[model samples]
Target: MARNEFRKSQGVVPFGVGATVDFENESLMSAGLDVWPSEKAEGAAWLKIMEATQIADGRLARRLSSDLKRKIEFFLSPTEAPELTGFQPQQQPGRVFMPFVRFPNWYFCPRCRILKRIAWNTQSSPNAAELKCSNMGRRVEGKGDPCGSLKISRRPTMSPVRFVVACENGHISDFPWSRWAHQNSDKDCDGGENGSLYLYSTPSAGLAGVVVGCVKCNSNRSMAGAFQKDVLHRIFPSGCPGERPWLGPKGVEECRDKIPQTIQRGASNAYFAKVVSSILIPPYSAQIQQILDRPDIWAEIESLPTVDGSVEPFLRIKAKNLGVDPTLSFKQYESVAPTARWMQKAMSCRRKYVIAMMSTRHMEVLGRQSLSVTISIRREFPSRTIRIGSDNSSRG
Candidate 1:
């Protein structure tokens, strides 16, 4: 039996799309956005994110919303739904559904330590996928060994290998097993692509303890220095195939990183989300922003006359349509689509106010390589005084 659970903290960093999650002795990859149910996904927040990203960087925004067209979804959990006592809505049971597929399809039998790569149907649900020790209760003949034949008695649960190959350009694939085992040795694997590999640990502690052996050729190799940077490049000369298994079987692309780096599944640099954020200032606050974000409202606002500060009157009407407080004074509502004349007047007034406030504070004059002085005087401010001289123009 398998259980699926998600933590709120995991949604942002490690558990996003293309991320590999090791859960309950299984390594599963977070599926692409296409698998997510539309009703369960949050659209408004995503739209806002797209808008904010567009405002920050148009190219990146287009890539996210138009080019890839993959929207970031916020999955709703059971607790998020409010319980109505008297009434029942036409809704199903509240449980978040996020589809995950088995990644790095390799698994090892714990009892025999025999490494096996299982062919899992990507279109099927991960819940239906099961890993077992098929070698259990089977008689196997040991070739060219002192112990000629042996019978497998014990049945043990299989575990996913910790090792995987990845590139800097976000492409990941299974580690080269047969190639690594027969790398330096003269023994050639007879099983070819379907070669049976076994992963057994010695009495030693870390990677030194781990050994990968081919059943066909009896050539075994220790997993020493497997986590090194450029080790996989020596094994696979063609470099990273740009395989994006998380996106699906057909998600392969041309990768820029010629040589793929070997890393554990839980490595920190495995996945990096490129996100752009925009901080809306002044006129784009709360209710006003909501209205401005709407193309229809903005179009109407732009079409309205700006003569004699008439934009304020039109904005007030739009704000009312958006359910904004009608009782707010001119100062409170001034920033929302204010007219050009009003903007100039407001800026002038604010500059005057700032000059008045700063003139009262003590001005510090510093002499360095480049000298500058704060000349806001209570005496000289009433009169228009523009000091053009630098305070400390001489170098030390």
Candidate 2:
């Protein structure tokens, strides 16, 4: 039951994918329509038909070949279906086995501060007056006429229990009522089974004033430190029993994490869903495609040195093949050139970018632009000599 609550809190609701509801804690039920239209057989025969048709459909097949240019794919055959029995088949595609089911009919009595699970009868008309407090017997002194017992309305009167117990290891269950009231001292009480338990709140409007008690043993305790970090562990000492009531009786496992109390279902900290996501990047690029189409021109450009002597010839060849401007002189290229040290720094940065892009499994690009660039030199040509006799006509 607690496991189901945890699953519901994790957004696995009824009629949705991954919903498995156990009715009356007797039979495990899943919510999905049977895909096959016949009821001839119940076991392997139904599964074989489902595996051949719905499960082996192209939409459910594995992607085998991907076209880099178009991002299209030729899908392969679906994985071999495992042999299983007693599976509730769904006729439609995308049916999932839900981990838990919803318990929406449960209600709480605000006056008495108790939770009650209400069962609905499909044959009878729904009555709001039928939902009543189980503590009606306590209202009478002895055993008077039970007719005067108060009826607790489902809404605005009876509410769901607002708090539950959860541990650090992701195990959650209903708050331990008997343990809290008995305080680990009464081994003979058998929790609260031997007596009736009552929850009451004082006028202070705080958890410190709310109290839970057993009528038979007369043991009571306040909820003051229930939410305190590691306080429950100190009180109980046994730690969390790893109770997952949603998974049924065998759900209990070994867990030693500290158990802390949490608020109702809708509370922010009640459930924390873990999610993962990634960005999809296209493998093909127009610039890369153009470069690949003319490998000879790319090879010529790659072979050129980063010196001024190579600039003019490289530009002429680039202009003829790659449509770069041949008229642009060496001075133009020199104006944008950096120092040798700066060139080394830029190379280091580019290398890091390349390594990062290659190492990632998803192959995410750094940005929307190409990192390729032509290296430039900033220094003046050493071959050009400075004449001391410059402007002789002006001197004359």
Candidate 3:
């Protein structure tokens, strides 16, 4: 779940595509609703669909594709639709679907901090629902519960551990508790059936007091430097495990990037959504625009005679047929195409300038080192008159 302060400051909750959200003791991604079923529901029904007008931005709308542009335009524009009883026709005018990803139904007991998988739906067996620690019967000095007996807790007492392992390439997965605790210079626990791991937290609130240990090999490691940069690589020289839990159980990839431990799901560096957007420009001229709108007419125009055959006749004929002015000359129609082309080029240049300006402004605002680049354009013009004398000003 995103922090309340972050959501408030952002003025919008980060619940769109590639967003990480916590629900039912699990971290999940918001999948695109376009992949959802039209009739039957496959995943959880926790999403609340709303109108797209709430978060609509003109800048974002300008970047939409033709299909999405048409849909959003239709929704925002006034149009008539059939009215139904007990429902306002304009209540939910738009269809902007939210994306979601499947999350593992796992939980950790607060007292023991041992990981456990639970069912997706616990309402059916409410009376039998409980998380029991694996080390319930194990006895050690100052270890286990206060009585050192089997520990049982209600479902509410368990919460999902907020820790997750992430790489610089944006791959995220559950923390490697078994590998971190067992695989070390002093101990080489294979994490097989014989290896069992447990987490312990001291009275100190800092991460220095947190510990992970393997019960079988008696190997333990502290969480003190886990949050430090490149510390995981130093501890486990094998590099990241390339785990992508969001993609499911078998979605592992080959990644050699440094993996860092993140303590909270809502951390600023936890998830980064990669998006690419474009601005769509419409045709400018009504005469050429009409021809471009229909592929058949455009193809016919391309197939016309080219050897000294004037395009004015074709333009005039097409313009007359399309109810446009027959007086529209080829020169007038041809000039409109370049206007649109120049507009597109200008838009591209403006976008680049805005991005560079924003980057410079951000560095200045944060009092960081300002990166500057200098570019010079040299042009040579033909001299109208050349001096024969080469005393000082003449050069080859």
lDDT winner: 1
Q: On residues 1-396, what C-alpha lDDT tens digit does candidate 3 reach at each position?
A: 221111211111233333466644445554322332111221112111212112222344443424233323111110112232342223323322222354434456565555555443332111344433344534334464532254343323446566666665445566666666755637666642331555677676688778777666778877776676666675447666765553445656787755455545667655433322323232244444556456675456556666127556877887777777656445555644443343335444542211010000001111113221111111122323321111221000
Output the worst ten-in-a-row residue range by lDDT, candidate 2: 355-364
lDDT of 2 by residue, 271-315 (tens): 332211122232333333344336574455446675446756775
| lDDT order of candidates, top first | 1, 3, 2
lDDT of 3: 0.42
Q: What TM-score fits each model?
A: 0.54, 0.41, 0.46
Error of 3 at 278 (Å): 8.4
Cα lDDT for residue 167, model 2?
A: 58
Model 1: weakest 10-residue lDDT segment is 354-363
Each model's lDDT: 0.51, 0.38, 0.42
What's model 2's lDDT at 69?
25
* lDDT of candidate 2 at residue 186, scale 0 to 100: 54
User: Which segments of model 2 are wrong by more than 4 Å?
Assistant: 1-108, 114-132, 140-158, 184-191, 257-264, 277-396
The order by descending TM-score is: 1, 3, 2
Candidate achieving higher lDDT, 2 or 3? 3
